[model samples]
Target: MNAQTDHASTVSGRQVARAALWLDLLHRQFPELIEELAPGRTGAPGRSAPPPDAAASARRSAADRADRDAALWNEQHGLRGAGGGSAPLRLHVSDALRDITDGVVELEEAIRDRLGLGRPPRADVPARLRRIAGLLASVADHPVLAEHVLAECRRMSRRCSAALGEAEQLVRVRGRCPWCDSVSLRAFPAWRAVLCVNPGCRCTEADCECRTSPGHRHTWAETSWSQLALDAGVDESELAVLVEAAEPADGSGSVSGSESVGGSGSAA
Candidate 1:
C-alpha cells in the first residue's frame, strides 16, 4: 500500500480510527460498486441502452454476492436478528458496518505493513479521526460493543466478500501471498484466497494466522468471500456489492471519518 497508513498506530485505537474512515469510504464507494456489479445490463441495445436487464442479472448477482458473505460469516460468527431488526437494525447495522469497515481497513493496512504488502497510515486524518474515535472510546465498556462489533461485521459480510475479490485480484497481479503481494500462494480445495482483519501481523500465505500478538506483524487468518454469503440472509449478488463497497484501499486510506472496528461480526 502507501506510507500514509502508518498514522493509525499499533493498538486497538487503530481499529476505532479506521472504522470511522472506512464507514465514510463505503458511502463513497457504494455507488461505484452497484454500478460495477449490477450496473444495469444493456437490455436490447436501443436508443436508451434498451431497458437495462435488471431482472435476470440482478438475481444472479444477488446469489453470487450472498455466497461471498456466507464465507466470511461462517468462519468468525453465527447469525443474529440484528437484535432489533429494521429501523434499529439499520441504525445499528449502519453504525457497526461503518466502524467494522474502517477497523478492518486499518487492520488490513497494518497487516500489509507487517508483511510489506502496503504502507503505514498517515497523520493527515487526525482531526476527523478523533471525533469518531471519541464515540467508540466512549462506549468501550458497553456489553453491546462486542455484539455491535459482530453485528457490524455480519452486516458487512457481503461487502467484505467484494473487498476480498478486489484484494484477490491485486494479489493475483502482485501475488496471492497473505503477506505483501511479493509472493505467490494458492488456495486449498474450493477456496481462492484469504484476508486479514488485523493490523499488526505477518502472514505471507493465504491461510496465514499471524497477528500482532507475536512479532509476526504481517500474517493473519482470512476466511474466503464465500463464507459471508453462507451465513447472512442477504442475497448473494447484493452481498457482493456490499463486499465491493466495503473493500479498504491499499493503505489505511478511506473515504473519511472513522470509528473503532467490531470485535465480532453481527452474527456473533
Candidate 2:
C-alpha cells in the first residue's frame, strides 16, 4: 500500500508540472495575441514650421490645399493597402504567428495529455487481473505473480479518441450567461462561464451570447468541465489525471512530477 501511494504521488507530481508547463506557455502566448491585436505604437509628432498667421493662415492654407488634398493624402500615406504591402505583410506574419502559436499549443497539449493517460498507475486501473493481483498481494502472495500485473499494465492503453472527436465537433457559442447544470448545455461550476451550442445564435464576444438573450438560462463554456465530463461518461477528475500522465518523461520512464489532481487551473 505504501509503495502504491508513494508511486502514485510521484507520478502525479510529474504530471502536474508538465501540464503547468503547457498551460504557462499558453498563458504567456495569450497576452502576446492581445498585444498583437493592439494598435501600433504612437510616438510624439515631430516639430513642424509655424504658419505666417494664426487663424488667417489656417483658413488660407485650408482653402489653398483643399484642391490637391485628396491626391496629397494618397501620396503621403501611400494607397490603401498599397504601402509596398508592408503593413499587410506584417499583419500576415502576425496572423500566421498567432495561428501557429494557437495550433502548436493545442497539438502539443493534446499529445502530452494522450501520452500521460495511455498508462494509468499500476494500481488505479480496474480489471479482473488487477483485482486478482491485489488479492494475492494482500495475502503476502509471491511477487513472481506480479508478471500478470505487469502484463496487464502493458496491455492497457488510454483512449482519448472521444476527447479529440469532441474537440473537433464542439462548437463554441459565446454570450453573457450565468452557469447552469441542465441535461442541456451547461457552464463551469465555480466561474459560471459557458460555451453555447446554439449555432443559429452563436456569438464571438468575450462574454458568450447568453447575455444577448434576456432572461435566458444557459451554461458558461468556461465553467462547464464537469458537465462535459458527465455527458462524456467520464469523471472530471479523469481530465486532470490524464493531464498528469501526459508529462514528458526524462531519460527514464519516470517524470519529474506535477501538481495535484483536479487543481484550480482554469480549463480555458
Candidate 3:
C-alpha cells in the first residue's frame, strides 16, 4: 500500500479497535449493572468485598448512589412489571446489544458479499466484532470499504456507549490539553476515559507521548491520568480533587469545572 493508504488503514484500524474495546467493556458492564438493579440479587457470583481503601470505597459509594438513582428512576417509570425487578434494565441492555449486533452483522454480510466470501458460522457479539475487525483489516487497501466499515463500527460503539451511560458523567479537568493547549479536556468517569475535544490537536509533537494521531483529538484511559497530569503540569492529587469537584452534585451527567491550573510545557 502507498503511504497515504497505509496511514488511512492504520487510523481506521485504531478506530475500529477502539470501538471494539468500548463495546466489549459495555458488554461486560451491562450484566453487572443489571445485577445491581435487580431486587435481592446481592452482587455478581463470587464477587468479593472491595479492599479497605478510602478512595476505592468512595468511588464505590458514588457508583452505588448512581445505581440507586437508576433503580429509583425505573420504579418511577413503572418499569418494575411482571418481568421482574431487573427486567426493564435487562430489556434496555438487550435492545442496545441487539442493535449493535445487528449493525455489525449487516456490515459483515455486506463486506462478505462484496468480497464473494462464504457465510461464516454464527458468533456472539465479541466474536462478531473480531470478525468485522479482521474483515476491515483485510480490506484496508480498499479505502471506501474500509472507511464504510470503520464508520459502522464507530456508530455501533457510540450506540452501545450511549446505552451503557458511558458519557453520563463528565468531569472537566482543570488544565488545557497538553498537546493542543485547548481548554477542552474532559474526564468521563463512567468510561474511565479522558478526551481532548480539539479536532486539530497537535499530539504528534516530537516530545509528546500521546498515542493518538496528530490532527485528531487525543484520548487517554484511566491508566494515563497521571501522565496526563504530569503533562498538564498539575499534581495527581490536584487532578483528583478537580475531577471530584467537577462531578455534578445531583449525579446528573453534566460538565462542571474547578479552578484552572497553570499551563505546562508544550510537550508531554
Give the best candidate by TM-score. 3
How displaced is residue 154 in candidate 3, in Å? Answer: 3.4
Cα-based lDDT at residue 203, candidate 2: 34
lDDT of 2 by residue, 1-268 (tens): 9998776555544433333333333333333444444336355578545546688888866754652454456557864444432344334435545454444333333333433423222321123223332233222222322332222222121111111111112222222122232123323221223343333343344565455764443443434556556553435565444433443243332222323333322123
The CA-based lDDT of model 3 is what? 0.60
Whole-model Cα lDDT of every candidate shown, in order:
0.38, 0.36, 0.60
- Candidate 3: lDDT of 229? 81
The predictions' CA RMSDs to the true structure, in order, are 19.1, 20.7, 16.2
TM-score for every candidate vs. truth? 0.27, 0.24, 0.40
RMSD of candidate 2 to the true fold? 20.7
Model 3 misplaced stretches (Cα beyond 4 Å): 1-7, 16-20, 23-88, 168-268
lDDT of 1 by residue, 78-187 (tens): 55343332232233334444554466556434434444445544432333234333455533333334234323433343353343233223121112223333222222
Q: Local error of candidate 3 at 242, Å?
A: 19
Model 3: per-residue Cα lDDT at residue 216 = 46
C-alpha lDDT of residue 213 in model 1: 47
